[model samples]
Every structure is written in structure tokens, then in C-alpha cells.
Target: MPEYNAPLRDLRFVLHEVFDAPGLWARLPALAETVDAATADAILEEAAKVTGGLIAPLNRSGDEEGAQWANGAVSTPRGFRQAYATYIEGGWVGLSGNPQYGGMGMPKMLAVQFEEMLYAAGSSFALYSALSSGACLAIDAHASETLKRTYLPPMYEGRWAGSMCLTEAHAGTDLGIIRTRAEPRADGSYAISGSKIFITGGEQDLTENIIHLVLAKLPDAPAGPKGISLFLVPKIKVGADGSLGERNAVSCGSIEHKMGIKASATCVMNFDGAEGYLIGEENKGLAAMFTMMNYERLSIGIQGIGCAEASYQNAVAYARERIQSRAPGGPQARDKAADPIIVHPDVRRMLLTMKAMTEGGRAFASYVGQQLDLSKFSEDPAEKQAAENLVALLTPIAKAFFTDTGLESTVHGQQVFGGHGYIREWGQEQLVRDVRIAQIYEGTNGIQALDLLGRKVVANGGAALRQFTGEIRAFAAADVPHREALLDAVQRLESTTDWLLQRASENPNEVGAASVEFLHLFGYVAYAWLWSRMARVAASKRAEDEAFYDAKQATADFYFRRLLPRILGLEASIRAGSDPLFGLAAEQF
Candidate 1:
């Protein structure tokens, strides 16, 4: 297996060159003192060592000896417990947590790079810690001060882990129909009675306790989604003195036999009147849950990029080593049977495509991470609001497009390996299976498109769309040599937005019908902006590192000349809206 190295150079380029994250960090009062260029670079270097040297080695073994369920207890694969111990001991679980609560309080922009490395190293192992961090963030933000004090520190230290229980067998996307219930008791706490399926990190031996943020409905609460409430139900309840009490009512019924991420335990949890405390106000669970959901949605997208990076590294290594037919014009390696597979044009195309998409996705994630920071820390209220709106508008696109492209890139990487790719030993097949869940979970890509079209775009009368497009236009107008490609991308986005708005005005079903294509079109345009910015930065830094910089420029050129043209096909499909999608009769089949 090839060793995984964090792309620190690319990360720095995206932060300092593409987004100027240092300037943004300096402007934010909360981050100004803690996160400078030196600090960020040092963090990246350490994260690279931990991920590449320690975590990557366990990936293949983890897959082979996946989490095992004996009786009701879950046991993680070999080396995972030790790796997780190192991860927590290094304070990685709290990289972006509150400083007051024992967290490192790192900015999301910097933490995102660490996240990318974790995913690249071993996504299955990373999932457990990521969920813990995300759940802790939500609790710290919305839960009572008492709850935060009780839970936040331990979770940050990784003495305890966390899980989010939202999905049920019948109520995956439609939470309005969920059957979970929470009954109030004499004390402030409630007894949660429900069964949650597909709960990641729900039950495991890696931690002393598992804190679950579950959604259940109150008996007297209105009805549907409006009646739902969020609860903090721990596996083992903590007494008022901060010591462990009796085990809570929650139990792991069974572990899921998933297609990928086998090392991460996904369980069907049966909460039989589990002792639970409300996180926020009643009937507002969805609103509070969005705090965690939004974070996870973007994190899942990074998971895609991370897996794609891993796949690309392995594929590139394989292509350079595997010998095949000689070059068309001349012999590059006459000592071998023919020449290395890297000399082939078609293999080069596949590798380049993966490179372009993976790098583009990294730049895009960094850009979104910057927006998230600005939204929380900007001094001006208007700037904050604009940042928030941008985050909302682009989040679904980030989640859907990055993961979609990730799966495609991983498949292409697998193709580069030919028959060896299909076998488990090469680890190519695992990357494909693991990346696929990123699209399906955290609200499916189809649901993400619906959210973008119905709630964010059409319902808001294109306010968010206009805000995003304005920035893209301004970037294109700036001094970038790839101005033509940038301008073309901007115009294409404007055209697609106008068509969707006009068609959806008269046709109610048009938005849903065109949602997926619209999202892809938006993603292509967004990636074009990132590619252009990266190309300019790479060109300016050519003297420092010619190979890396040249690679960036080549990929950008490929994205513009080859990949951006796909928007035409999507636009055509969107313009032919609703009719084909909803026109088919019910009994036609």
C-alpha cells in the first residue's frame, strides 16, 4: 500500500493565495490572536505526520478486520484503539472546539485541512472523531450551560464520544413522520422511547460513554416536524457530582452490515425510555439540529475529497510502477518489458481528471470554510449576513457536487488499476464504496438539490443566488490571466439561474425536475472560479516549486478547456424541465 501524505503545499496555496485566509483570520477578533500563518503551517505539519505516518497504516487492516459485534458490545478493528488514543491525546478531536472548554479553538479553515488529512488517511476511523466533534459543537452552542459544562470537556478530550440519531427505517428524509417519542418525567429530564437506525458511532468500545443527540416528539406538541425536539441521551448517565451513574436505557440492538466504512460502527439503537435531557426549546429540534447538520454536510463533502486524494495517490503510484506497452514515438524505459503505464496517454487523461477534480474540490472546500469563519466572526453585520447567506446557498452545492465528483474520481482511479483495483488488497474498491455513502447520507444528493432549488433559490426569490453570482463576477473582473474562462463560467451560471427561475415560475414541478442538473451547473461554475484563482497563484509561485505549480496550471487549463463544457449538457436538460420527469403516467410501467 502507498503511504498517504497530506498536501500541505496545496492547502497553503488555497488558504494564503486563493482565499487570503490569513487576512480574514487577522480580521476576526476571536481567531486573530490564535491562528496566524506560522501557527496554521505548524498545525498542518503535525496533522500530516499523524495522519500519514500513523493513521494511514491502519486503513487496510481496519477494512479486513472490521468492527465486530459480540453479544451487544462493539469492538473496533486492530490498531484503531491505539490510533484513536493518539488522535485524542494530540487534541485533534477538539481542534475547532471552544477554548474555555478545553478545546484548541482552531479556526474552521485550518481545521478543514486537518479534516481532509484524516479522511485521506482513513475515512472510517475519522468518522468516529468527526461525529464526536460535530455533536459537541452543537451541544455547546444550543444546549444549556449546565449541559455544556457536563459534557463538552470530556467529549473534547475524547474520554467520551458522540453520535447523532436522526434517521429511522421509514423516516429517512421525511422527519415529519418519525415515530420516536419523549415523555416528560418528574425531574427536568425526559424518558426517550425510540429506535434510531443508521446511527454512526452510536455504540463502540473506543470511548467510555456515547452521547447521542436524538430527535423525538412530545405527546402534547403540535404535530409533524413542528412537534419534534432534540435530546442529549448518554449511554451512561453522569451524576451531579460528575461521576458515572447507572447505564442509561439506550442499547445497541445490532450493528449495520454496511457496504463501506466497516470499521466505523453504525448501529440500530433501541432507546427504551432512555434518560434524556432537552438540548433546546421544544418543537424546535429541526432548527437546532441544523447547527450540527450543516457542519456534517460540509464535513461529509470533505470526506469525499479526502477519499479522492487517497485514491489519486495510490493510482498515481500504481501507474508509475506498473509496466505496459512502450510510448508511441519512443522508448522511455528500455530496461523494462515495455514502459511504465504512466507513459500512456489514456492513463494520463484519467489521472489528470482525478487530479483536477480532487484539487478543485479542496480549493472549493477551503473557500466555503473561509465563508463559515467570516459568517461567525466578521465585524460588520451586513458582511456577516452576506457570509451566512453564501454559506447556506453554497452548502448544498458543496455537499452534493464534491461527493459526486469524489465518487467519479475514485472510480477513475480504480480504472487506472485495471483488474487489481477490484480486489480488496489494493484498497481501490474500498474507496469507491466508502465515498458513495457521503452522497447518500447527510441528506441524499437528490435531497440536497431539492433544498437548494425549493428553499434556498426559488423560495428566497434568488437573493442568495444574486449574492453568490455578484462575488463570482467581481473575482472574474479582477486581475487573473484566465479571465476568459472565468467570464465564460460566470455567464453560464447567470444563464442557468435565469432559465431555472423563469421556468419554475410557471411550473411548480420544474424546480425538483431540474434540481440535480442545476446543482451540477452551479458546482462547475464555482470550481471554475477556484481553478482560475489557483492557476494565477501557481503561476506567480512557479520559481519556488515548478512541478507543483505547473501541475496546478495544467489542471486548471484542463478544467476550463474540458470539464467546464459539461454545463452545456446540464443546461439543456434543465431547460427541458418537468415535462419528462412528471409527464410519465402512473401505470406506464
Candidate 2:
């Protein structure tokens, strides 16, 4: 197994140099006094030490042992409890949470990089806290002040973990048909009776109690998604004084045993007459749940970025050290029997593909994070609206595009290992399995593409997408290398957006049929914009750091030259219309 490093230099480059997070933080009065460049750097360095030294060692072992469910309770793999203790002790759970709730109040831009590191180190362990952070964000935003005071502190302290209960056996993506019931009780509280499946960290040994943000239908509610209501239910009841009371009726019926992330407990939770508190207004659960869902979406996107980073690191290590054949350019390794696999053209191609995609993905995720920070923290109303619009447009793309690229990158990483990648000893195969789930969960990539095209772009009349592309256009117009290529990509995205807007009015399937391709095209263009910006920055800094900046430039060149052309194929496919896709009848298959 390869050792996990945090890639601190790349993280810092994106944060301090590329995005100027410290300057942005200084402008936001909420974060002005709390975080600065030095403090952020120190925090990241400490996080690096913890994840790399402690959490990473258990990744393979935890996967090997998996989470055990002997009785109703679930137990995490060995070393996980101790690692989690250290994690909470470091106050890592509430890294970006509200300060009023014992959170550190870090900006999303900074928090996201740490999240990527965490996922890269150990995804199974990371899921436990990822769900907690998202739940806390939802409670802080939509829950009552009394509820927030009661629930937020312990969660931030890591004494209590959290989970989002949205999926059921019958209703995975379509929550309109869910059968969960939230009936009104005599005392004004509600009894939530439901069974939620695919609940991450729903039943765990690391925390004292599990706080679940559940979705159920009320007795007099309307039909479909509108009738649903969000509820806050806990495994152990808590008194008004925040003391733990008797156990609630919630229990884990069973834990899933399949695919990757075996160490993370995906449970079937049964809430039998369990007490739950309503969140937000009644009959508005879907809107309330999106608060957490959107946060989880971006976090899951970072999971993809994390996996890609880990895979690239391991593959490069293997490529440099594994000697298999002589170089095509005669005797490169004169002292050895054969040259290292790094000398081969195909191997280099795979490695570069991994590098370019991973790095481009890292930049793209950070850009989205920066937009989130601007949306949340900025005081100016217009600026906040603009930032929010961009976030709405880009969130789905980030979630889908990053994970899709991540799976592709991991496969390349696995390919680099050849036979060893297929085996269990090297641990490369586990990465392939673990990352596969990211694309499926947090709203599948197909659903994400629909969300991007149907809801964000077309529903909004392309305003949000235009705002995003406008920013890209301005950046491309700046004095940068490959300006023409960047402009062409942006034009392609704009024209494709127009085509979808026109074609969808005649045939609704046009949106669904063209969404994935449109998203990929947009993703390629977005990366092109970032690459051009980075290349300009690297060129200016080439005199200061010769090799580092040059390598950055070379990678940017590769991204533009090799990877950006994929957009052309995507554009062509999207313009081909939906006739071929939906031409078949229901009985044709």
C-alpha cells in the first residue's frame, strides 16, 4: 500500500496564491477577526499531520475488517474510535459551521481543501463526520434558535454525530412516494414512524448519540414532494437542559454489506413512534432538506477530488519505481535489466491524464467553494445574489463532473498498477471500489445533470449560467496564454446553452438527453478558464520558482492541448438532438 500525503503545497497554492482566501476572509467581517493567512496555514499543517499520520494508516485495515454489526448496534473498525477521538479533539467537525454553535466559523474555501485531504486519507472514516457537518449546517440555517442551542454545540464538540435520512427502499430519488409518517402528538411534538435506508453514520460507536434529519409525510399533507416535512430525530432523547434521557425508539435493523466503504455503516433505520421535532414550516420539507442536500453535494464532490488526488499520488509512485521494460529510446536504464515503467509512452500518457484531470478538478472544486464563501459571507446584497446564482449553476456540475472525472482518474491509477491494481494486497483496487459510490450517492450524476440543465439553467432562463460564463469570459479576456482557446470553449458553452433552451421547448426530452453532454462541455470550458488563469500566474512566477511554476505551466498546457478537445465531441453529441435517444418505444427493448 502506498502512503498518503496531504499535498499541502498544491492546497496552499490554490488557497493563498490562486484564490487569495486570506484577502477574501479579511473582507468578510464575520471571519475578519477569526482567521488569517498564518492561522489558516497552521490549521492546514496540523490537519495534514493528523490525517496523514493517523487516519491514513487505518484506511486499508478498516476496509479489510469492515464495520461489524453483531447486535442492533454497529461497531467501526479498529483504530477508528481512537482516530475519531483525536479528530473531534482537534475540533475538525465544525470547521465551517456557525460560530454561535461552538463552530470554528472557517470559510468554505478553506474548509473544502481540508475536506479533500480527509477524504484522500480515509473516505470511510470521513463519511462519519461529513454527514454530521451537513446536518449541523441545515439545523443552523432552518431550525429554531432553541433547537439550535440544544443540538448544535454537542455536534460541533463531536460528542454527538449526525445523519441525513432521505432514502428508503421504495423511494430513493423520488421522495414523493415515501411512506414515512409524522403524526402530531398530544403534547405538540410529533411521532415519526418510518424506515430509512442508506443512512450514513446512522448507527455508530464513535459518538454518544446520533442526530437524524428525517423526511416524512404529515397526516393532512398534500401529495408528492410538497407534502413532505423535515424532522429532527435523535437516537437518544435529550432533556431541555441538554442532558441525555432514555433511548428513543430508533434502532438499526441492519447494516449494508456491499461494494466499497465497508467501514462506514450504511444502516436501515427504523423509527417506531420515535419523537421528532419539526424543522421550518410544515409541508416544506423538500426545500428544508435541500439546505443540507446542497452542502452534502459539494462535500461529495470534494470526495471525488480527494480520491483522484490519492490515486494520482499512488500511481505516480508506482510508475516511477516499477521497472518492466526497456525504454523506446534505446538503453535509458543502462545499469538495470529494464527501464522503469515511467519511461514508456503509454504509461506516461495515463499518468499525465490522471495529473491533468486531478489538478483541473482540484481547481474547479475550489472555484465553487470560493463562490460559496462569497455567497454566504459577503455583505453586499448584489454580490451575494450573484455569488449565489453562480453556486446554483455550478453545484450540480461540480458534484457530477468531479466524481465522473474521479472515477476515470482512479481507473487510470488502477491501470498503472496493471496486475497489482487488480489484487487486494496493493490496496489500489479498494480505491476503485470506494470512489464508485461517490458518483452514485448524493444524487446520482445523471440526476445531477438533470438538475443542472432542467432546474438551474433552463428553469432560470439561463441567467445563472450566463453569470458564470460571463465571469469566465472576463477572465479569459485578461492577458493570459491560450486566450483564444479559452474564448472558443466559452463560446461553445454559450451556443450549446442557447441550443438546449430552444430545442427543449419543442421536445422536453431534449433537456434530459443533452444534459450530461452539456454538463461535460461546461466542465471542460470551466477547466479551460482555470487553466489559463493558472498558466498566467505560473508564467509571472516562473522567475521566482523555476521548476515549480514551469511544471504548472506544462500541466496547464497539457490540459488545454489534450483534455479540452473532449468538449468538441460533447458539443457535437449534445447538438445531435434527442430523437435517437427516445425514438425507441416502451416495447422496443
Candidate 3:
């Protein structure tokens, strides 16, 4: 099995050096009293210890053992139970939750890095906490004050875990057709009866109670998504005094046998007359659930980063030790049978590709996290609105782009290991299998692309896009080496956005046809902008850390030279429109 060492140095470079996270935090009055650079650094160090030491050790073992179901209850892999205990004791579940509710209330900027570390160490183990965090966010945002007071503290403290119940046997993404029903009772609670499938942490042995944020249709509700409502259904009911009552009418039907993240309990949950309380306004469940969906989408995107980071680390270690043919120019190790594989040009290319993608993905995720913090904490209305707009425009891109690159990066890492990568013993194959799901879950990357192009861009008439590109244009105006290239990329993206908007109006089919490539093109340009920013920062700090800063410049150059050009092809394909895509009829297949 491969070992994991937290990318602490690079994380510090991104957090402190590039973003000046401490200064940003100081500016947000909400966080100024509680968090500073020193506190953030200290928190990150402790998080690194927990993830690297406790969680990373269980990754391979968890995948092998997986989660098992007996009778109606699910049990995680052996070490997971213990690791979860430690995770709870560390107060990690509430790392970015509301401080009034017994949470640390850390800013997203710092929490995001810790999140990447968690996924890097153990994604399956991380799901248990991840789902809880999303569910808590939804509850904190929309649930009643009584609900928050009773449930938030315990869930944040990790005494009770949480799950999101939206999918059913017949309904997956189309929640409008869901058969789940919630009938109101005289006591103000509702009787919830639904069967939810693919419910992560639905029935686990780790926590005493499981808080389920379920989506169902009310009796008097209208048709379709308009009628859907959210309810707080607990596995074990909670009484008025905040005491645990008898078990509710909820049970796990079975656990899914999936390709990866095997240790996470993905259950088919059956709720038969289960007691539940309404969360937000009736017929507004989808909106309320979005609070969780948005959070989980970003977290799932980071899962891609986590898996890629692990794969890259292992690939690098293997490349340094495995000997092969001599270098093209000359043998580095004269006395050995052959030089290490790292000396090979092809191998170096693969390593560099992985490095560029993973590091760029990290920066991209951090950029989004910063926007989220700004949206949440900034007092100025204009600043807050701008941040919110950017978040809306970029959320879909971050979710889709990160995962797509994440899967690609993992594959590249596996390729560096050759045939050994396909074998189970080396662990590279597992990384590939695990990272694949990130692209498919919490709304598939395809959905994300459509959301970006159709809803976010087209619906807003490109206002958010213009706002984002304006920032990039201003940054490119700075005295950076790649100023011209950066400015050119911004222009290309702006032109492409205009083309998409114009053509989409003429032919609605063009939107779906062009969305995936459009998102990818946008992603490439965004990463280029971020890399340019990092390069500028690195150049200024070259005197302080020569090797690190030099490496940053080299990677930025590699990305600009090799990867950023991908947007060219993407733009071409998008401009071709939907004619070829729709030419093949349904019967053709």
C-alpha cells in the first residue's frame, strides 16, 4: 500500500503565500476575533496530523474490507470505528460550522485545505463526516430555531451523524417523480414514509443517532419539484427535552456493492411511518436541500483532488525507486544496471502532468473557497453581491472541472506505475476506481456542465461571467511575465462566452451540445489565470525560497505551454454547434 504525507509545504504556499489567508481572515470582522494566520496555521498543522496519521493509515485496508451489512444494520471496516472516534474528538465535523452551535466556526478558506487532506488520507472514512457537514449546513440555514438548538450541537460534536435522503428506487436525479410521502399530524410533526436509495451513512455503527434530511411531497402539495418539501427525520426520535427516544420506523434495507469508496455505507433506506419535522417552508424543499447540495458538490469535487494527490504521491515515490532503461542522454547512476524511471522523458512528462493538474486543481478549489468566505462574511453589499455572483457562476465549474481533472490526474499517476498500476497490491488502481465516482456523484459532471452553461451563464445573461473575467483582466494587467498570454486567454474566454450565449438563443440544443466543452475551456483559462497569479507571487518571493519558487515558475510554464492550449480545441468543438451531436437519432444506436 502507498503511504501519504500531507502536502503541507504547498498548502502553506497556497494559503499564506499566494492568498494571504491570514490577512483576508483579519479583514472579515466575523473571523477577526477568532482566527488569524497563526491560529489558522496551528489548526491546519493539527488537522494534517490527524489526517496523515490516523486516517491515511486506513485507506487501503478500508477499501479491502469495505462495509458489511448483517440483518438491518451496517458496520464499517474495523479501524474506521476507532478513526471516527478520533475524528469526533478532534471536533472536525464542525470545522466550518456556526460557532454558536458548539462548532469551531472556522472560515471555508482554512477548512477547505483540511478537507483536501481528509480526502487524500481516506475518502471512504471522510464520507461519514462529509455528509454530516452538508446536512448540518442545510439545517442551520433553514430549519427552525428549536431544531437547530436540539440537533446542531450534537451533530457538530459528532455525537449524532447525519444523512441526506433524496434518491429512491424509481427516482435518482429526477426528484419530481419521487413517491416518498409526508403527511402532517395534529402534533405539528409529520409522518414520513419513503424508501431512499444510495443513502450514505444511512445506517452506520459509529454514532448513536442519525439525523436524516429527507425530501418528500406533502399531501396538499402541487406536482413536480414545486411540491417537494424537506423534513428532518431521525433514525431515533428526539424528545422535547433533547433526550433520545425509542427507535423510529426507519431501517436499512441493504448496502450497495460499488466499484469504490467501499468502506462508506451506501444504503437502501426504508422509512415506514417514521416521525419527522418539517424543515423550511412547504413546497420549498429543493431550495432548502440546495444548501446541502451545494456544500456536498464542492466537497465531492475536492474528493477528486484528494484521490489525485494520493495517486501522485505514490507515483512519484515509485518513479524514484524503480529502475529501468538508461536516460536518453546518459545514465545518471553509472554503477547501477539502469537509471531510475524518473530519468525517462516519458515518465517525467507523466509526473509533470500530474503535478501541474493536481497543484492547479488545489489553487482553483481554494479560489472558490475564498469566494464562499467572502459571500458569507463580507459586510459591504457590493462586495457580498459580487462574491455571491462569482460563487454562483463558478460553483458548477469548480464541481465539474475539479473532478474531471481529478480523474485525469489519477489516471496519469497510475500510468506512471505501468502494469503495476493495474494490480490490486500497488493501490494505484484503487485510487483510479475511487476518484471515478467523484465525477459521477452529487450531480454528475454532465449536469454540472449544463448548470454552468444553461442556468448560470445563459440565465444571467453572462453578468457573472463578465464580473469574473473583469477580475482576471485586471490581474493580467499587472507586471507579470505571462501578462499578455493571460490577457489573451481572458479575451478568448469572453468571446467564447458571447458565442455560446448568441448561438444558444438561436438553437436551444446548442446549449447542451456545447456545455461540456465550454466548461472545460472555461476551466483551463481559469487555471491559467490562477497559475499566473501564483507565478507572480513566486517570482517576488524567489529570494526567500529559491527552490520552491523556482519550481512554481517551472510548473506554471509547463501548464501555460502544454495544458492551457486545450481550450483552443474545446472552443473549436463548441463553435461547431449541436448539428453533429443531434445528427445521430435515437434509433441509430
TM agreement with the true structure for every prediction: 0.98, 0.99, 0.99
Model 1 C-alpha lDDT per residue in residues 479-570, reported as the tens digit of each score: 88578877887887777778788888898889999999999998998888888888888889899999988988989999888898998899
* TM-score for candidate 2: 0.99
- The digit string of per-residue lDDT tens for model 2 on 372-441 reads 9989989999999998988888999889999999899989999999999999878788888999999999
RMSD of 1: 1.2
The true-versus-predicted C-alpha distance at residue 164 of model 3, in Å, is: 0.7
TM-score of 1: 0.98
Which 10 consecutive residues of model 1 have the lowest summed lDDT? 580-589
How high is the CA lDDT of each candidate model? 0.90, 0.91, 0.92
Residue 184 Cα positional deviation in candidate 2, in Å, after optimal superposition: 1.2
User: What does the lDDT read for residue 307 in candidate 3?
Assistant: 90
Give Cα distance to truth, residue 589, candidate 2, Å.
2.1
The digit string of per-residue lDDT tens for model 3 on 1-589 reads 7888889999989998888888988899998998998888898899989999999989898999999999998999988888899889989999999999989889998888999999999889989999999999999999999999999999999999999999988988889999999999999999999799999999999999999999999988999999999999999989888899999999999999999999999999999999999999999999999999999999998998889999999999999999999999998999899999999988888888889988988998898999999999999899999999988888888889988999888998889999999998888999899888889889889999999999999998898899999998888766876778778888888898899889988998999999999999899889898899899999999999899999999999998998888888998999898999878789997
- Flag the better candidate by TM-score, 1 or 2: 2
